[model samples]
Target: MNAFWNRWRKQLAWESVPAGTVEGRADRDPAVGPALTDELERVLTPVMRPCAGIALAGAAESPIHSFLTGHPYLPAGTTWPEGAAGPQIFVGQINFAEVASVGALPGFPRTGLLQWFVDADDTYGLTFDRSAGTAGFSTRWYADPSTAAGSPQPDAPTPTDTVDDLPMEFVGPTALQFRHSISIPDWSGLPAQHRSDPIWERLAAALGERRADPEFVYEEYVRGGSSLLDQLRTASKVGGYPSFTQDDPRGTGSYPAADSGQAELIIELDSIDVGGWGDSGVAHLFGDPAALATGGLTSIRYHWDCL
Candidate 1:
């Protein structure tokens, strides 16, 4: 995810008030937050971020805290996470203690078992909320997994999102390995402040494009060595820039960004094998940097989109 967008990173000086609170609990809300000006892009440093690329190994060795799918570990005293419909389907989890041993992401939790589950029935657990906030999708975190001694299976029936006659069920109880890497933001995942920085034109001008169609300029940037976006190994990852098949789910009337710096990507679970979202897209959980730094898991939001 590293590339052209790194030419400049800016901080806008608009005096809009912040809308979403940084406190524990809940999803995203439209922010009356700051906006970046074109001038700021010229002086600010570039935004190159560090992230861990996740690869699905074979079946998990055990139920113990580790990055894996299908098999979920329920901590002692914790009830299964249920969404609006009924019981939620287990997605996967990350044992950050293991993550800390390998790579790192700024402000993310260093220890704990951060697990994910989504709503059953229709819509694949998405609430359809413009901001994609709310408990439509649930994320559970156990600061310590000492008591989580049992592996879990889907309490609800698996969804049948057969595409083109390709049958589907659950991804797998596959073990996962994390390799530390660097990532850069995409046109759609640029910071809120930078959205108004006329990047499309800047990119076009950089390529000396006489036509300058926003979409065409980007295609050229990726092909012209300005960005390795098309080659980034982030189909699955933690704490990296987001990759959306559709539009940037923030600030607009539809997809809203998390409060201020609170919406950084926590995890990106792309549809793999048997698991699919709509027409096969990625699911992302963004959390508040403040809470993440303190290892608190309640402050977060859920979002998924497809082409």
Candidate 2:
């Protein structure tokens, strides 16, 4: 990763904006109202263009602006290059009840206010998880296709820890940046025969056919497994895996319900490595109670790096 991304990887703790802050500001401050409108237009124009029945500009009555605006936190005068195509906008669904449940995971907020920006070359996103007491930013550049094709290492070198000292300024108070050490479970420590266990077989199956290098599978599994194990630990503390009834009693089954236990697990697991195994992957792995129970895997061995 480059210096730009190195800074973004760290989750920064920022002061929370109370509910109604944005709405109140829009009502009272004229600048705030236009700024909100301008921003929504700037951010959402590209995303709505390809779809019909969506209007992004003007005094036209549209739910698009109403939904996109009123975010408590707004970007601080950041703009894409002039005349350049606008970045795509993505809004994450908010579940207030779930937000109230988890409270906060170690490095993640119980609730997240998400906004994403994507252009042809790079992707950027900002989110506030008040429950986690953090406002986080992330970016990934697609400029280097080679990086994706390169051999996956046993572990990539720790990106230089540069977020803490960057001179960049934001609209709010200076946020504190934290570096979390990546933790990987020591699968090697398992008895040679344990590799053949039913649980490992199931997990390997869930991982699907391994077209990638065998070494990459092993390394990625170890890396991704660390966070997975951590989530299971947290879930155990908060009340074990969520309960899910089989509605079909035959089909692949429904996704796990959005509950406190599941929410906390997802947050902490995602925090492990910002751009690593994504939210869907994490959810799929832990969503099933049966898979986790098979191996008696909760106390697996692991190591931590505190960079």
Candidate 3:
């Protein structure tokens, strides 16, 4: 068995919360007490957003905490081949609705296209809300830096690891793609938030068009780059992760503003084999690496939508 998978298998059992907790938990184990429920709900409510609801199209299991909470990969004194790259865990896809109401909009509204919960105040955490969907959606988590953690081998990561660190200040564009199934919620005959607004009607029309040409949508954005990969390569090298601006003389107007800061090499998820993913502990998923090199990987195809 792969050492990475070995570690994952050990955590298969369900981690439960008590009754009346944030998520639907066991009767005996309440996740949080009533004293904190109001505060918790307040924090959680903002994450839900006013115009949209998200469904967990799928998620790849994250590396062990010991693997990421400081270290990017397995910790020291672990066991695996010196150059073994384990199965890739790609987040499958996501579905968003305008209001989760009937006749409103079947998909995300374009008026306010900002990504939800990417703001600073949102914290990183996970919850399993059955009402939301099976394999509940996640919000506000930070990026994963994998190669920095010296593991499977005793070698320490090079300085390039830190360069990719995704603090709030760094920004870059991400071209992403992914595929998965969606279970549209049962919202029937609901009124729109505002009268004379056609958001819902527009959404219905879009769905009608999508029925003929069902396809995964792709997006290009001048947003944050992959800070996770930046740190990994930097940790493996010195100075910082390999830096090279898109060497296009046809400069200024083509891309976003010139951000000379270190950026993570691009990661292209070739294809998603499965979705609606979950586990008691260990899970396995794999994909081909579209880009993994010195200048930083590019040609990424994994794109997920957020309402």
Candidate 4:
């Protein structure tokens, strides 16, 4: 089996919070407890119903601890709001054998894995398709509805300003940002037959033979030049995942600016075939080269903060 497949299979078997148990657990928290419950009931419940037999896991003590604690793409020391309570995340996963379970759900494809994040505020949800290497995420934050009737809404920026021109400042104290990523190992050392995919052919031609050296590094895709979010948006439009537009309540329609000072690269790997391993599209390639040679993606880390 491909190393990535093995790793994901192991994760699927890891201990997880039982399905239908998150609501009761949220009740224990004092700060964000009620909000979590409300979010799950009002927002997530209906959204997740189609994913029959979906299992839930808590990430607080999972192997992804370091990522949740200190993500490289987020500001340093990023943590949940001080004294905030409730599970930081509830991972929803459909077993690999049951990939077809969610096929009837809008925007979901028939893939071996369908995982997503459900946060305390219930304001954000991210869906990751492991088989397709695609992700769809949406976040919404606003004042409590009871007091929002007459509140002044943030002015929608003039259409003239591109996303790159938007301010990088944090949106609010309750808003959270999350990312799902995958990494492709070094292709330079792979046999020539493994590099025959047309997409690889184009990538190699574009990089030129000399620049293809293992140490030369090709990060244009990582630096946001490849427009990862845009690809997600396109995939969403094509029913690959649910569509999230800026017009939705408090939704930004795209990832906020990277505060960790590293360029956020969400590369799209179309027609990717790994010698009977599988293929995917719109993959987010993490920017580390050392981890690539192993032939599996790093954890699909999920990070969020109150800011």
Give the number of the best model, judged by lDDT: 1
What TM-score does model 1 achieve against the real structure? Answer: 0.66
Q: Which tens-of-lDDT digit does each residue in 217-290 have in candidate 3?
A: 10000001211111112111101111122231111221212122212212111112111112111111111111
Question: In order, what lDDT does every prediction score?
Answer: 0.58, 0.23, 0.20, 0.24
Question: For residues 180-255, could you state the per-residue lDDT of candidate 2 as single tens digits?
Answer: 2222222432345433334443333333423334334433443233222111121101112211111111111222
Estimate, for each residue in 1-307, the C-alpha lDDT of model 1 and write its tens digit.
2232232221111122243332221232222111222332341236556777777677877665564445477644457766676666777788886666776677777887778777775666666555355557777766667633564544534332221221124455777788776665665545566545566665554334565665455434432244324334446678867777786565543334544676778888776632566677777887675586566666577778887
Model 3 poorest 10 in a row by lDDT = 214-223
- Which stretch of 10 consecutive residues in model 2 shows the poorest summed lDDT? 47-56
Q: Which residue runs of candidate 3 sit more than 4 Å off their true CA positions?
A: 1-69, 73-307
TM-score, model 3 to reference: 0.17
Worst 10 contiguous positions by lDDT, candidate 4? 268-277
Error of 2 at 192 (Å): 6.8
TM-score per prediction, in order, is 0.66, 0.20, 0.17, 0.19
lDDT of 4: 0.24
lDDT for 304 (candidate 3): 20
Positional deviation of 241 in candidate 4, in angstroms?
11
Full-model lDDT, candidate 3: 0.20
